[model samples]
Target chain A: MTVVTDGQERAGDVRLGRVGRGVRVAVALVGIGLLINGSVRASDDAWPFGPMSQYAMSVPDDASITYTRISAQTDAGTTVDVPLNIEGAGVARAEIEARTGEIVKDPSLLQQVADGWAKKHPDKPKYVKLELIRDTTQLVKGRVVGPPTPAVLATWEVRR
Target chain B: MSARTVATRAANWFTPAIAFARIAWLRTVLYLFVIVDMHAFVRDTRLKGEHPGLYQPLLLARMFDLPKPTVFNTTALYVVLIAACLVGASNYFPRIAGWIVAPAFTWWVLIGMSDGKVDHDHLALVIALWVLPTVKAGRRGRASYNDQARSESAGWVIRCVQICVIATYFLSAIAKLRSAGWALTWPGSAVLTWAIVRRPHPVGEWLLHHPWMLHVMQWVGITAEFLSPVILWLKGRWQLFGALFFLGFHAANTAILLIHFLPTVVCWLAFAPMERIVPWFQRRRASDSDAGEAEDQAEHGREAKEQAGA
Candidate 1:
């Protein structure tokens, strides 16, 4: 094996051919260009090359912080908060939040959440009704003013 | 300077020779992390398949006309990904394994992030997967962890990964600026308070009491992200410090927001000379074996003396 201790070209040192180098440079340029373009103009739909806009928007001090919660009335005649997590409902809160517009447009979209919960918890009491409740907390100077007010945005009666 | 001299300098900058062994080590780490990621962070990809009507394909997925995730297809993807990642991590058939992993994981992530929100944390990681396969591990392959031989191909790939990692940060700062109406409104705003209140974790709940500390943290975060490119230029201890600083940043985010940017964090290995780890371990092992041999020889000599006396 050819070993070179000095900072010089050696037989053992691997090098890319001219074509390989050209291809890599071109790829790098294009990738970087797309990233810049995505950040400047594209939305989340242009993902893998989209805006790094997580927490990019700032919330005003006096604005209300809204959270979409899933509350279900079970066959056991009790209402409980269905946690928007993979284990709880087989869906993330963010996923539900992302499609809030659609859910608001069509209340029937919530059947999926009920179906998911049923699939995950086969033995538990089936949900009779699933409500998308928005809990809005009023903030003053970055501090919570009072308890959040829960408003039901949409409701879906589960089909048994 | 002459145009020829400038062009040569630019070419040299793009292809600085880096140890091939670093690529071998990074490849193993990245591939293995894919398994951890699928099981934990993006576990919802499979669940999303069950509700295909909710599936909103990203631009890339839509452009390629990739099939929508189904129960069968997603399960198949999960099995295939796990198998491919294992083989790639093992350093066997790296090119083929890497090629499979690159597109598969990208598709997996596309499906996972197709909901309204797409995480910027994955930018570097996804790009790394694409570029890593371009370079081969030479004849030694998996056994080249201590190859010591430097290559321009390895350097080029490493550079590409590093750029993307920085872009995830630098562009994020720009995104913050753009979203805030080209003003520095982000650092001074109550975004953290809103997030903490929304999530309601213990540490974050405690942080809710102290508003000033959160404001300071926002300023520090944006400043670091804006200046993230300096890490690439930093050498030796400074570069290490820069990397560790970002890691600490992620740790704080986890502690407060419970958000783990592990994908981006794992790609930070690009900044390190990972190949040195193998040699370091080998040296320790050599010393350990030497000590063991000396002990054995001493025990044998003592036994020989005892027999002579007897």
Candidate 2:
């Protein structure tokens, strides 16, 4: 029943008692400190308090932009682009991009994408071989110069 | 200023009394939004569980030694979270439901964003969840929608949410500056152009032709974000304008880059006087009913006079 009217503390108005106020102040200070530390020093690993670095890096106008995509040779004897979406392969393009280094270091890791695809689409033509492809587009003065060049960074042949 | 005076001023600023009803309204909005968020936005948590090998736990998850998301655990978390959020939105058992939702959603978000890309938009949202449970309602464990009673606890929680929301913007500007090697090169760079070209919508594709306009937008965006804290001190219409401007900013980002920072956007309601919403609706309904009653009386009076004449 505690209420505050016009800056006057009326009886029964719920107040943050001395201890409550102190605790909150401490928590706020710590939280803000961590946020500052994260921005200054930490990486995405310190998430929920880490650097707010989405699109933080600047891309040069003339720089080449690379997009990673999965290309697969299906059992149907046709080469098709495997979508990097949850519905497509049970994984997102960002997920693949995040593990690009690991996948590049170990080409066999591409088998997981094949497994994911098989799990999602059991009736569809299974992937016979999976290639981790990078399509690089050259940009000049912030405009695309020409068609993108697709390069295969890693490949995995289905063992089945 | 004297040390005692400084302490008193700081205390007053942190614990300004605010209507408890605002918390009730905000809780409903935020908890309900969690359902929308889980299904539409971070729908990959369950799928990520299926591919546990891909789960690269973040720092907090790692520190907590949270088990790598499994089909069983993730599904369990999903069910628990939905149920808790629904109950929390109902305004019953506020603390219990709020506490359950706070950690579960945090863990859910942590799992969903375990990939190399952790979105900055979630910072304020996650903080709001944690702090909301600390504020208690009346003895019945619920704050009425029309409750005029103001509490310092409510103010503190709202302040925390507001601070985090502003921090999301202010810190992002700092991050941009840092990433540009502590130089002011970011605003002048073709970051927006690069993004547009990377994920080309029709509008963004057309924007690709106007690189100078994109550069100007980058400068304007960074400057506004850096100066975003001023919104906290702004009163009345200015504050609303600031909030609307950011919402517009989000709308523009969504239109161009297909990126919507809804999590942070929803938290902007903290800056609003949401306690008035329920009262406003109630008054309108009451007035409508009163007019109906007056019309009924007039009709009865006319019918009585006609009967007497007949």
Candidate 1 docking: what grade?
acceptable
CA deviation > 4 Å runs, candidate 1 = A1-11, B139-142, B288-310
lDDT of 1 at A155: 89
Question: Candidates' lDDT values, in order?
Answer: 0.83, 0.82
Best by DockQ: 1
Show the lowest summed lDDT stretch of 10 residues, model 1 chain B. B301-310
The estimated TM-scores of all candidates read: 0.92, 0.91
Tens digit of per-residue lDDT, candidate 1, span B67-142: 9999998999999999999888877788899999999999999999887767778888888888888787753555
What DockQ does each listed candidate score?
0.47, 0.45
lDDT per residue for candidate 1 within A35-60, as digits (tens), equals 89988998888888888999898888
Runs with alpha carbons beyond 4 Å of true place in candidate 2: A1-12, B139-143, B289-310
lDDT of 2 by residue, A1-160 (tens): 2222224455656777889888887788788899999999999899888988998888887889888889999999999999888788878888888899999998877787889889889999999999999989888877778888999998889777
